[model samples]
Target: MGSGRRNLKNAAVALLSPIPSIIFYLSLLNHCQRISSTASDGDHSLSLSPLWAWCYYHPLLLANVLFFVNVNVLFWVISHIQSSHWMIDLYWTVIPVMLVHYYATHPLAQYNWWRSKIAISLTWVWGVRLSHNYFRREKWQWGAREDWRFTDMRLQYGKHWWWVSFFAVYVSQQVFLIGVCLPLYVIHSVDEPLNIWDFVAIIACLCGIVVAFSADTQLHDFVSRNQKLKELGKPFVANLDEGLWRYSRHPNYFGEQLWWWGLVIFAWNLGQGWTFIGSFINTMCLAYVTKLVEEWMLKQDYRAEAYRLYQKTTSVWIPWFKSSIGGKDKKA
Candidate 1:
């Protein structure tokens, strides 16, 4: 049937989309090997290929180049083919882990071995936790849904969505993803020994993970209870204000920021304080995203009043005491 053929076509597209990026990576590796051999011969001439030279001497630049080819190009192609940009969300959980390993394993990478191990381990923990939450929220379905914001943008862009997504979804991600992972690069690029700041970073990172995990778990349960209420034809709960939700309108966002900023501590400890730029930009972007999310909530007829009250009382990002101005609503 046509449906079967269409499914097959999509599967093929998904499988083949990364071929170009894979080929590019292999070629780059081959070039790097050649350069290593040439350098081992003590030939100090400037006859090296410019691209290979840059990749060899500048790992971060090489990462950006690979990110452009893999995420911006290949991810966009697959998103276009699938008519959904959900893959980016899935990869978001994985890419930081990839970047950390990439920087740690790069031929020119220089860092304390134990520090690199700690960074890699923490990143994997974060990635695995996020990926698990993502899959659970999606009912373990792949590419079945995207972030609601993208859906809204798709409607806003109309026929132009195809191209607009290339920038909005893929291009913007390059900035955010690479920016946020700058700490990993910093950790690998420096040869700093263990210090007290490492302990601080470890505590901060672990706390962030714990907070995010707890908040997400509470949210999941709230959503699940709401779904059951709907299934049983009972009235739905308009807003969640219990647990971490009571203190912060977006504890998960706060926790995510904490995680990144925690990593920034590592970079800062390594004397690369400028690496905070990535986490700062990410926090700014999340602020805008929070605004959009609140606007969306306000637009919903059932939850509008409840969420409005919640917003007035709850801190926006940081978890804190509720405001006294908006008396706790009995309905929420």
Candidate 2:
């Protein structure tokens, strides 16, 4: 029965992978047609520049298409990988995709020009690279399930709810993507030249990139080391004491917060005035996600008790202090 269920799941992934692209493309084309028709009805109908029209209307569509395509590919590839439960694996990417959809449909998209452009660009880059990297790292196996989180979710959601769960997963990702990238819309709206605020935003973005890349690199290295150890018949143990992990229980999470908030800062620099709402939302959501993950990690491993210590000492969302001089941030 388990084997049969796995086969069904793989088949479902195969079928659904291609559907998102078609839907994305169709939606984009439809939106374009609407915009063109609307423009043609105005007095300056003939004056509407084709280039301008595309520049203004195409970024969101392009971003959506890129995100959908990458995620679908990820689904096809990961579904075949015999590792990790599928549902939890789906959560990471799914949340972001939902944010994408939300931003695409949000009022900010209509008002924040530069914000939209930056958001679209960042989404395209992050989604494509991450998806490709993920697909390349994992191999396929027939009748294999996905990430353990997915399995847990499947059990929790019940056996008869896969269809609903599937759509929810997809839609959730769209909304996440939209929400996280909201600052881009605000950033794009700026009509002024770069200023001090832009410099501040640039610094924040650079810091985010460095810290995020460093944390991920460290985590990957740790995982690789563990795999090597396993190959030598060593038991798997939680290794969170060294490097950035020592500083914060979740340095990668911290970096992620910085990256998104940095994007929000960019929107602030662009100063679309009311577009600040997008930045505010992004920051708030980042805090919430970080908090949730921290709590979950704390629960997942009580033996180490390192997470609780790290939480107490280090700043939750910001990488502000050193662990050595001050000791674990007693008031993290």
Best by lDDT: 1
249-331 per-residue lDDT for model 1 (tens digits):
99999988889999999999999999999999999999999999999999999999989878878889899888866454332
Residue 198, candidate 1: how far off, in angstroms?
1.0
For model 2, residues 35-121, the per-residue Cα lDDT tens digits are 666765553324435743453455666556555555634553453364333533433534444445445553224534444544555
User: Backbone collision count in every prediction?
Assistant: 0, 43
Name the 10 consecutive residues with the lowest summed lDDT in model 2.
134-143
Candidate 1 collision pairs: none
- For model 2, state the Cα shift of residue 298 in Å: 5.2
Top candidate (TM-score): 1
RMSD of each: 2.9, 7.8
